[model samples]
Target: MFAKLKQRWQDTRTIMKLSLDAEQRALREGQQHPGAEHYTLAALDLPDGSARRVFARIGADPEAYRAALANRHTAALSAIGLAAANANVTPAGASSAADGLAPPAEPTLLFDAQPSGQTLMQSLPELQRRLPAPLCGAHVLLAAAAMAHSAAGRAFKAIDIDLQALGSAAEAELRAAIPS
Candidate 1:
């Protein structure tokens, strides 16, 4: 029982770390809440780089997906008559009705975990069951990719990446990392 509790505590800590990382991405993108997209970015930036390898293995460009995410945010702001002043490129020239958004918000270092974070937290047990053990970036991304209606899914669609291919690649990465 104590061992089980200890493992759960470790898992919780891991999830919290991922959430903090995702939240940083959200705040940097001027996103109100950290969702699957932010999580996807965080996963790609994970020190292990496991998620990134999946993209490379599949002959895909994670950088392009990152750009698409930026575009996604810019388009979102554009749709609301707001443009990101620091956006990489404006798809639509500034409209007379458009207003520029302020630079990315300051970090609060607080926990207001959102759905994608929650999804990652909830998925730990299932992930441990299916993958080797001790969750990593690949697991976080796999969860985001599995979300049928998430921003990550949309970004993949925008980048022309097949979701099944991504998921399969991520799974293979995890399995490959397991000690022989």
Candidate 2:
């Protein structure tokens, strides 16, 4: 029983680490608070994982998705007459790459701002209840999809991807991956 508890504790720690990584990415991008979109970006950064498989099954490239997300934010800023290039964003730490899953070289200091109305934090409990022992990138993606009104959802819509179908496929894959 103690071993089981230890394993659970380790899993929780891993999840928190990943969450922080996502938050750091958002902070580097000039976001005061990390949201579903940042979570999705971090999930895509996973070197090899279920999240990438889900993207493959849905015929979406994670790299392209990341670029599109950046473009979307840029366009939004442009619409507001703000120059995206001049945005006061910090460069990533040495350990954090533009397109890699490495952890930041130094700890990132994030603001105390809350996430947007639609964020993975709101859906994580339900997702954890549905998934197996260790939650992973795929779980994050699933949760993001569940929040259809989220920034990630809007991004998916903008790219003409049917989120419902993607979510259904991800669910099936997750179920299949679980051992009876």
Candidate 3:
């Protein structure tokens, strides 16, 4: 049973590598955890896919999206009298104490134990039930959009992007990408 479970997990990892990579990148960049924004960013970074095409159709450049996200984060932090520069000051998994240095001058963003990757992973079984396999970029986009209350969703709304329409377009792209 353990072996079977391990195999299943590995298969899932293979299908979700891009999304997972995004989550890792977010952590490395000093995000407390990955969120819908991270997922979307990852999808955009794919070499070629539905997510990229969708952004292109909307005249949204990946760099511009990243800048917007950073600006939003900075604005939110500034409103609370916190500095955005400190948000990503420390590398992921590195502790100041471990380096014999004093603790950070400011408190870091507090995050729940459950990261966005877990949330995305939890959504996958349902997605697998509804969508065909070899989960592609479009699948990640749809999943991210489903997280309507996530930071990415709010950011999209602020920018006048339509999540529902984006999801529909992703689904169509996924269908087109698959061999009939």
Candidate 4:
């Protein structure tokens, strides 16, 4: 049974590698943006309908999808703050839209956990550390599993998968996704 499971895992990894390879080839030969492809693939890998919606919108206009997702997260966080207030949790320095007040200057600093003048500023090196090596190595494997789960197929979501004519778009997406 253990051997079977290991073989299954290996097979999944192989499938993910093939999918990524195909996507990359399509991007290179078809003149598609790699970031768009990455996000499109990422959407397929996700297990939620919300991600499907975001990816669908992204396929139409990448910028619009990015903004919509950001706005949704912001609204969710704001709602959490309001709920905490109702529970008498005394959320620190959180403001609601109803306040009709200007944005606080120190909000960013507070969120970043920076210290004041009296306290020595310390860096959390761990925060800057890349994801685990094993996790990174298993990327293709995860992608394969997602594909096998039928997440990568058209049945999952509708996306424009046109691959043709190489352009600067793929390079731009690669630059955006991979930090220099």
Which runs in model 3 stand beyond 4 Å of their true positions? 1-16, 57-59, 87-116
Candidate 4: TM-score? 0.20
Candidate 1 lDDT score at position 7: 63
User: What does the lDDT come to for candidate 3?
Assistant: 0.61
Candidate 3 lDDT tens digits, 1-180: 986577567545644555555555455545545666766777776655667876666655656666667777778778999775573443322223323433323223332323555676567667755765445566777787777687666766666778887677767776666534
Q: What are the clashing pairs of model 4? A: 30-164, 31-165
* Candidates 1 and 3 compared by lDDT, better number: 1
* Highest TM-score against the true fold, candidate: 2
Q: What would the per-residue lDDT of candidate 4 be over residues 1-180, giving only the tens digit for each residue? A: 986577557545533443343334223222222222233333334333223333343354434433333343345457767433332221122234423432222122122211210010111111113221111212222222233222222212223322210112322232333323
For model 2, the run of ten residues with the poorest summed lDDT: 90-99
* Clashes, model 2: 0
Candidates 1 and 4, the one with greater lDDT: 1
> Candidate 2 lDDT, tens digit per residue, 37-128?
77777776665387888888888877666666777777887899987665354322212234344333443443232464235765665776
Q: Which consecutive 10 residues in model 4 have the weakest lDDT in total?
A: 116-125
Off by over 4 Å in 4: 1-11, 14-41, 44-59, 82-180
CA lDDT, every model vs. true structure: 0.70, 0.66, 0.61, 0.30
Scored against the true structure, residue 44 in model 3 reaches a CA lDDT of: 72
- Residue pairs of candidate 2 with colliding backbone atoms: none
lDDT of 1 by residue, 49-142 (tens): 7888888988888778888877887788778888567543332212222224433554455666567656755775687788865567888767
Q: Following a full C-alpha superposition, what root-mean-square deviation does model 4 have from the true structure? A: 19.2
